[model samples]
Target: MIESGFAKNLTGQNLSSHLGPVSGKGDVRVGFFWTKVQLRTKNPALNGKIVNRLCIAKQPIGDRYTVSHAYISQQDAARLYPQEFGIFTQYETAPANGTPLSDIPGVSRSEIGLLELHAITCVEDLLSLHPDQVSQIGMAASRVYKVAKGWQDKKDENEEILTAADVQAKAEEAIKAMEERLARLEANNTRLQAENDVLRHSASGHPAQSAAVTTAVQAAAAPGDDAPYEFPDDDGFMAGGDVVTGNDDLSDMPDPMKD
Candidate 1:
C-alpha cells in the first residue's frame, strides 16, 4: 500500500495512525513520512525484505509539497536487462529515393511504385532483386536495380565505378606516358643546348679570328713590317712567301713572317 502527505510540519500528525491496523493475512507493513519514524520486524520470513523509496516535490511557493513513498513486493527482486530494437514502418510500397526496382532510363517517379515492394526497404535490397520477380509486379525491376546501383546504359562519367586496381593501372599508364614524353622533351632540350653551345663557341671565336686577320693585314701594310705569307717547310724555295712593302732581303724577313 502507498500513502502520501503534505503539511507545514510534522508536530501533531500521528505517523503510525495513518498506517491504520494490519489485517490478519498481511505479511508486511509499509508507510512513509517527511519526518523520521521507527519500526522493526523480527520475523524470519520478513528478513532481507527489499523496499523502494521515493520523494516527489511540487513547485509554486504555497503549493510546494513533498511526498515520500515505498514499494514492497512478495516476489524476489530482479535486475532489468534492456534490449535494443529497430522499428521498420511498412508502407503499401517503397518510399521515393528509398528503394529502386529497375535500371531503365527515364523512368518517372510517378510511374514507379516505390512504395509497393515488401521486405525491400533499401536501395541495396532493390539492386539484389531479380528482374523477373519485379516484372511479376508489372515494374521494371532490372532497370530500377541497375539505376539504384548507379549503373546506366549511357556513358555517364559520374556513374562509373572503377576498382582500386583499375584506377591504379590507369594512373600507372598515365604516369608512364608522361615519363616518356618528359624523356623525349629532355632529349630534345639536350640536343638543342649542345647545338646552341657549338654556335656560341663558333660565334665567340669569329671575332678573335677577325682581329688577328686585321692585325696581320696592318703589319703587312706598314713599311719595313713583315709580309703576311705562308710557305711549305719541305719546299726549299720560298714558294708561297710574298712581301707586302716589297723591301725584303729574303734572309732579313721580319720575325712576324718567320716560321
Candidate 2:
C-alpha cells in the first residue's frame, strides 16, 4: 500500500555526480533512500516546508540500462528485478553485530515491527535515521529514538567504568607483590647481620671459650652447620704433647714428677 503512491512522487535526478560513472557491467546499487520534496499544500505558509520520503532505485537492463540508472518504486523494483530485490532483502534482514531493537527499554515488539517496515533493523540503524525519516513512524518516533540513544550512552559509560576498575585492580596486585618481596629481603638481611656478629666475636675472644660458644651459636643459627671450619695456626698444643708458644719453641716449665 505504501508503494502504490510512489509513482505520484517519483522524480528524475542525475545520480552520476554522486554514484560515479556506471561500469560496463551495469553495476549499480539498489536500496531504500531518503529524498527531499517540497510540500504541495495550497497555503503559502506551508508550501515552503520540505519533507524526506523513502525511495528505491534499480539499474534497468538493455537499452534503458545503458542510461546508467533508473529510480523505481519498491513494488516495481521487486516485480521487475526480483533477484536484486531478494539480495537487498536478504542483506537487510541478515544478522548484524549491533544491539537489537528489542533490547532497548520502552521499545515494544510492535514498535520494532513498525521500524523494520522502514528498514531500521537495529539500534545503530535507528540512530542513523534522519529526524524527519524517523518521524515517519508517526507519534512514537521521538520517544523510541530518545530511549535508544540513552541506552547506548549508558552502555558506553558502564564500559568505561569497568575498564577503569580493572586497571586499578591490576595496579593493587603489583603493589602487593612488591611489598612481599621487600619484606623477604629485609628478613634475610637481619639474619645475615646476626651471623656476622657471632663470627666476629669468635675471631677476637679467648680460643677455648670462643670455640665452644661459636659451635653452639652456629649450630643453633644454621640447622645444617653449613658454616666453614676455621682453625688457628698458632694454637699451642702439638702432636708430641708439648706446648709451643708463638715463637715455635718448647715451654721452659718442667714436666710433672712420676713414681
lDDT, residue 66, model 2: 34
> What C-alpha lDDT does candidate 1 achieve relative to the native structure?
0.47
| lDDT tens readout by residue for model 2, 1-259 | 4555435442576555544444446555555543445676444344535544435755533223333334456687679778877777667554444566777987888788787777776799989887777877876766798888888889787997887876776666667767888999999999999999999887777787878988889887875635555345577545367566694443444423331
List residue ranges in candidate 1 displaced over 4 A: 1-139, 142-164, 204-259
What is every candidate's alpha-carbon RMSD to the true fold? 33.0, 25.4
TM-score of each: 0.23, 0.29
TM-score of 1: 0.23
lDDT accuracy of residue 22 in candidate 2:
40
Q: Write the per-residue lDDT of candidate 1 for residues 82-198, one digit (tens) a residue.
A: 110011112122233332333345665543555233555445565557767666655555555556556533324543454555566656666776788899999999999999999
